[model samples]
Target: MRTYVVGSGVTKVDRHYERNYLSLINEAVNKALADSGLDISDIEYLVVSSAFTDSILNQVDPSTYIAQNLGFRKTRALTVSSGEVSGAVALDYAHALIRSGKARKVLVVGFEKMSEYPSWIINRVYSKILEHEIEGIKNVSPPEYAAMIMQEYVRRYGVSREDIVKWSIKMHENAVKNPYAQLQFNISLDLLNRALRISEPITMLDSHPIGDGAAALLVTDESITKKMNGALIEVVDIESSVNLPIYLRDDITYFSSTAAAYKKISSKNEIRLDKTVAVNVYDTYDIYGLLIIEALEICGRGEALKCLDEMPYLNIGGGLKARGHPVGATPLYQVHELRELMSGSSWVKYDGEISLAHSMSGPDNNAWLILLRRWV
Candidate 1:
């Protein structure tokens, strides 16, 4: 049995002050169902992914309410949350269900609403992604962790701060062409330098913005694909790995979880970066995005910044930086963007058959890599 993504829908990453969580989910889900040429009745399962539902929404067992809101009375529904990688984790679960002969069609929805909360509260929630016993108790936040990594990376690789700034600038430029991106305006070196500092060497522009958004994908087995018209994107392989917390890791600059997941996928199928149409990486912070490219072996260690010009397809959707990191919804957004790009429906046109999406939890404590191939 093979799993394929037949349809996908994504909302623009923004504050979305007017819409509630249910409304956002409905919009994405309806669009996905429409695109797949399937009615709501066709879906047998629903997988919801969210990170801050408990803290932000004050809702527990979100899957139950979400299924009820979507009118999925009898559909088997569950929620998957693994910090920022919740979307990818949910996707992996849906893919497994189809491969295991459990279901023919699965609906995966990832959503997050962060703008409703104050910055202090949001930061406190995000800090919990760290090792709660150690880092969280000390109030260590993601940006602070990123600053440590960036400092070490610059020291180890001799990469200049200017080179890192260039990465954010390029991401903003890419977002200018992406209608769904949150920060859709091009940025300059001047603005980045002048931006308020979040931590030493990490300014506000270096981090992904707080936003609200939702994305949905309709995953179905090959049997359903036979009846669908046009090409479908196949889930070639989905692999994930876990690493010790950043405090336990010997090297702050390396993402062992990312490398481990990619290695597993590589053993199962040959991944040709040259043939890849686009690569979406988890760039909650600019430095982490650079580190992920290196972990994917797209470039040598510490060479990601230097080779940024060479990897034109990297983060064409503006990445988590400019595109917005709505936590659990981000990975789904990556897949949706890649699907559009492969089908030539994206604003940033690209002609290719393969794409890869990477997502990770805090500091690469857990990571997932999804390989997608266009089945024409």
Candidate 2:
């Protein structure tokens, strides 16, 4: 009934403008199998996560195509897309399959090819996140949505420009160590303060770039882990939720869906922050990571800055910002970072470590959080 991540891998998040979807995934999937000490023969099911493939590569039912090409022709395959949350959702499916005893091992892959199209075209595709009334008609894009939320948060919470810059700087620093990260340039807080603003307080540096890459994870039951001697990161709890829209949420200060997920994770695991060692919350933008701290109940409202001062914060080295937010592959990257951050002589980990990952598609919609723990 319990599922554990046996192995995981991610391709270097970079501009693979020359490569197609299948090619990108081929590298990622092969790395995943090698990491898990398993082969294609051990895979019983495949879950592919991609959203831009239809327009970018003119491909549909990519899961089947990937399965066929990977020599898992007869294995069951499913494709899922939920904007930026596509990767996390695919992971959720893999966990479900393992929990239900329907599959012994599920290979979950999330890939996106955004650089294949022009910026305007990519913006048009991202516009699907909004309603037909506002965004669909006015062409409000993802960056604009993030800008609005960020403006409101700064105004309401009195979060200074320095707070946002710190997050970006940290993520970039972390990316330097993460060879798989797309952007590894480090900018000091002083340099960030001098940069031009994007929309109000939102600067160009506050956002994640359009990246192309793939990430994969091989999830299986605990019994399989024992037999394989693979690295074990137990999934103690996982939950998902959605809110009608940003306006409909109880508060815009933090995502309601994330709050809902936090409650579920706590209730299921009966654990609290005192026991948690770290968190890898979705950080598509600087403000989102700031909002996540409050939403996850790790700190009180407008207390993220204080929390950062005392406790380690999200996106240690340039989270999604520097790491590359390859839409469909962000969640898997988070898991990858979590596993490494908790193992060996890592920067942050304790005797009994518990790490949490939180992600969302748009606003508060299609949210999910996973609680993971290191065994001994």
Candidate 3:
């Protein structure tokens, strides 16, 4: 049976000083159940996105604890972790369960709590995702990885600082309308260039915020979805590709996994990039955003900036750049953005026909792309 996402929910991306990880999950799951009109007992599977465990916070075994606390004792529970794309991986498992006749309905929840720890602790955790031996031993962060990617892109295409800065401006502009976005405020070209640089070509404003948030979605197939009204989306296709690490790849500027996945997708389906209502590429940094546009070949490799005027819905929910990447929960947030954009829950009424949510991990070596056709 074809799967459909019938319900979705996302907590505001910000520092929840009072809420713990369990509280955040409860808030998002309850909202999703209420919206989908599904009782807690109706859910047969629970897939939780698990990323990091903070020693300072005394957290452990998130999936087991969360399922029990949410009163999902009898339901089969599993956890999926792929660095920052935990949510996407979890969604894939949930989709397979029903497609395999394991369960008719499943609930996928992704959440992360980063504010409880110090900056250095967060850095150590993020560094390990890329390459534990090198990055973790040397204490290298994710932004530093993006910096190397940006510098290489500049050398290859002669991309100027001005060209790269425009991408950040576009992301910020899109975030202003998304209330769930952590950094909704806009920034000008001057501010972007002058802003403190973390890794050359990327500034503080260019990266996604560090915040705590959770998102949940209800997954079922098209057959059962017909009984419900119109609030559902069809998962037309799901594809994934894995490439060698950045150090092993021929070109660090290009993401081979994205290319391979899209190449396979294009042969089977007609992907009208121009017709897509929302395209959520993993935008770890502004330069990462350009590489995303270029990798998909949505527009010309170096011409991503020129198409910004027309790609207003590029990151309807500000993407990871402004919407805040709670790491594990981010892909789920992208799914939420698609639902809101089609349901008229977005800041403005989106006249969109199709939306695609894509996420990459380990510096774009691995990718997961999900195509959604609007049923509203």
Backbone atom clashes (below 3 Å) for every candidate:
0, 5, 0
Ranking by lDDT: 1, 3, 2
Instruction: TM-score each candidate.
Output: 0.97, 0.92, 0.94
Which run of 10 residues does model 1 get worst, by summed lDDT? 268-277
Q: Tell me the tens digit of each residue's lDDT in model 1 across 121-143.
A: 88898787888788888888889
RMSD of each: 1.3, 2.2, 1.9
Each model's lDDT comes to: 0.89, 0.77, 0.80
- The local distance difference test score of model 2 is 0.77
| Runs in model 1 lying further than 4 Å from the true structure | 274-277
- In candidate 2, position 356 carries an lDDT of 79
Error of 3 at 72 (Å): 1.8
Highest lDDT: give the candidate number. Answer: 1
Task: Tell me the tens digit of each residue's lDDT in model 2 across 1-376.
Answer: 7888777788888889788778888888888888788989888889988876776778887998888787886678989988778888888888888888998889889988888878668767766767759657876666666787877777888877667767777778778877888997887877766766655566768877778989888888877887764346877777888877765656676787888888888888887763145777777778887778888887887777666655553664357789887888888878877876665434555444678777788766778988888775
